[model samples]
Target: MRRRPSKEQFEQQIEQTAKALHDEMIAGKWAAGSFLPPEKSLEARFGLSNYSIRLGLEQLVQEGWIEKIAGVGNRVVATRPQVKLTIACENVTLRNLKTSGAGRTISAFYPWIQVEFLSMISPIPGTDLSERTLAGDLVLLDNVQFQQLSENRLTHLLEPLSEDDEWYPQFTKHFSVEGRRLLQPIVLSPLVLCYNKAHFRESGLAEPNGSWTWNDLIRHAELLYDGRGRYGFAFHIQSLYRWPLFLIQSRERFEESGEEFLRSRSSRLLDGLKLCKDILHNRKAVPLYLSENNDDINRMFMEGKLSMTLNTYMGLNSWNEAEIEYDISPVPYMDSPRTLLITLGAGINGSSEHKEEARLLVDFLGRCGRERESAYADRIRHYCKCCAQRLP
Candidate 1:
């Protein structure tokens, strides 16, 4: 004596069957583009009515796992959609990073999800984000980009993650909004003066130190400059990381005066700009083409064609790998020793359909290898030492 199931019970059965199918698909039981079993077979296997089988396949269809052909059977679309993570990085490819510490963490924790990186990034203008412009499921944003995201109300894309003991307070604060974390800091790099030791020794000039001022730097650069192919010092004058020190010095000076803050900003910025312009135009200490890129500067430094350059921890991995003999000191400034703190963090896209999965990836990356004994910790330590940052 068999009893037919109620409509609600049938629907529940459909949901369960759909979930099972989804799990199997993720487990690679069915290859992508392969057709599912016939409707009659599905009905017989699940012991469900024809309607229930249709409903279950429809569920899979909605989840992007399968595509329904009008007259044909259901075909697999994708077992898992690869999450796209956008990075505004230079000189490195996504393939190179995917097998690193964070990449291994993601792979171990999320065996089913794949990650892809898109690096070309353009600034979002006027505090507005068009979905067309933001083309990734997750984005690695810098401080400036974070400010833009905050202004444009796009930070809602970031999932709020549970803070762990491994996170450094100073680094975490950089990505926090109104006490809420918008992203998790994965990298911390401070601006520093990376000078070629051999060049200073060859020029018979004192190497740069914390006490050195901008004037001192310029003077040493002039002394080191050879009238031939070699340059004394090099850096991008328009860089936010290097140029802001001048503004900070100006602000300190104006703090003791009666000038308004905005007025101070304009005047101080111009003063900073004038200083940089003079270094290029009048002093002729820097080459006109030094602004080409850090690649050119790094190449020249490695080749012993440049004396000093302003850089951050981001340059350490390459420099160390190249075995370039060099040392670092705090960047020279006018009023006090100042450097910009650069942070790299990861955030999820709010509109992503797979938000829960994205959150898992973000969370794992934030705490992957911060422990003392961990292999990831060893890697982090190596990178930190290269950058001369204090380990937490």
Candidate 2:
């Protein structure tokens, strides 16, 4: 008699089956919203038992590759697309905040406040959170202009802000002064640097060894670029924070001794800028600044045209969706390894009559993970619970 499949073997079989089904869905062999083949038939096709087939389909469903109806077979609800949750706040540690008794009681007692995904401005596609307020729901809110939280409010505010031109100034100004006391902020995940490991190996370049410095990265780019059609690197201008990180790593600060604007006398800062300019101009490492119309740096990287780029954890989903082989590593560092940290926080609206209740909900949403944290994290790489201590 044939021996039973080992647990590892069964897992491999399930993964292979899921990939085949996914490929079929992608090729239009199975139309979207159409029911997938029955478990028995798939079992026969893959030469597995019905139990194994169900296991594979369950895996697919969890990965958001398909959905199961109450009476209908599994249907291709949607293809998992890459989603990013950009959060902004003041505090920099990834730890949980302690709430007082008044805060907990307020949240537990509120009835009108509900937590739900707001579809109007949600960053992910097809994922809806339109409900007013629900526990463990991800909501996106910007800074309330000309508004202040009450001193006795005891509320948490979660703000996910991107480092955009318009928002960064407001965020810096808001958090530098007002946010320090009122809000607690933490980066949910480390900044992720992803590159095509296969491409690097094929081009006779070493796979980035987990950590690298600015000079090390430059050398690798120089060696990888050969005046050929292939380019050494490509990055979105929006991710220009990497430039400042280089300065920070070199023990240089952006602010002057007593001024708010960035300092100009730091020779190290000037050197880093000159290096970037050289890479852009002389080395021809990166393409000339393309107009917004044709500026899909992620797409270019996915097409296997570039060797490396600096991207956030959320960008990993995009690479996965594009089916390009890649690996994640910490962002390049300088003298001492460091990443420019960004975080989101929850706060109460001072004007709302439900201010007390809102504070409770904010604390629960920001700190509670029993229900919503995993689901959000699975959908978006950056939507992590503040207290999740696992290092990645």
Candidate 3:
């Protein structure tokens, strides 16, 4: 006399039920030798039908949360999951980042979703035409790295997310290809001015705020420079992440490349480029030594080698526990007020056999990422399929 449970309803009940029981078990929830509460009690407690309760219990068994005894009930078999989840990644983003706040959260929470989270990441992949990108159950890439995989390749490699628009509308849709979603965002950060507060206090210069401009920053840099070991401000001018912000804020679609482009809104582009060049060559503004990459900038900033540098939230993980007193502010803009926002996201491999589990990871990260940073992850991906970005 019970009605049928819809597939959607059944799946939701199962996922939620498993997560709840998993939490309880993790908290030393069960009594009588870690035996799960009676199925009838679980059914009533979770508002799930008897069939739904059994299905939820079955998932836990499959996930190695418990073992089913003959004729009695399900009992704890492994305190930790015996499953190993493989995810294709880049070593720099995850392995070196475990010490950061966001990175630490990810490292800690990865076990919450699954105990044996195995990662085999390639440091840098070549762009050989014949070379194929080998993958596992999941792959994570930022917007810039996503370009390494061609549009057709990305389309073939990723599947549409089960839950569309689970994060911010802009980020949610950023992973779509040809109106079909291909990934979900997990973490994001906007470019901000990371500065040493002590330096500003020592020099009697007011800390930078939202109203700072290029000229203001340059003038302050001249003052902050000690002419001994430290400089005022420094960032890698050659970084793909740093250089592009100049052209983007210049505010032109930039289809034409000749004088026509320069005559258009591209004049701002020239100004932006000039500023970058001046900053790089400005002896009074930057350090004598060159910065190789963003990591170098972060390290020097933490060591008090420089007063300020442009960085993203993800980049802040390096200094999450640094003993220095540092704060972040809006990056000084040129003619237009804009900042480069970056996001790192996860996608299920199109051909992965364990796609359902991958979806669970995507969903779990999507839900959890919102808790960590509600608004900054994966803000740019599919929006500019051809790399022609429109202001967000």
Clashes of each: 1, 20, 3
* Candidate 3 clashing pairs, residues 3+ apart or interchain: 174-382, 188-377, 343-378
- 1 versus 2: better lDDT goes to: 1
Off by over 4 Å in 1: 1-105, 108-110, 123-130, 163-170, 251-274, 282-284, 320-323, 369-392
Evaluated against the true structure, the overall lDDT of model 1 is 0.66
* Root-mean-square deviation (CA) per prediction: 8.9, 20.8, 7.4
TM-scores, one per candidate: 0.64, 0.48, 0.71
lDDT of 2 at 385: 19
Candidate 2, residues 1-392: lDDT per residue as tens digits?
98989999989998899878966764457766788988778888999988888888998889786888977789987444322221212111111122233234433443223332222332321122232221222222222211222222323443322232322232334333343433322223345566788778877778775457756776777666667656777565433334444554455445545553445555676665665666566355666656241127667777777777776542343344567788766666545456543334344433344333344455445444223334444533332112221211
**How far does residue 330 in candidate 2 sit from its true spot (Å)?**
2.0
Report the C-alpha lDDT of model 1 over 1-392, residue by residue, as the tens digit: 89988878877899899977876775557888899899999888999879889989988888788999888999988455554444333223232233355555666655556665555334321223444445666666656557666777766666666665577676676677878887777656567788888888877888888788888988888888888867778876655556665655544344544566566656765686577667776345677674655567778788877788877665566665655578988777666455566666777766676665666666666654243225445434433332322211
The residue-level lDDT of candidate 2 at 290 comes to 60
Point out the worst 10-residue segment of candidate 3 by lDDT.
Answer: 379-388
Question: How many clashes show up in model 3?
Answer: 3
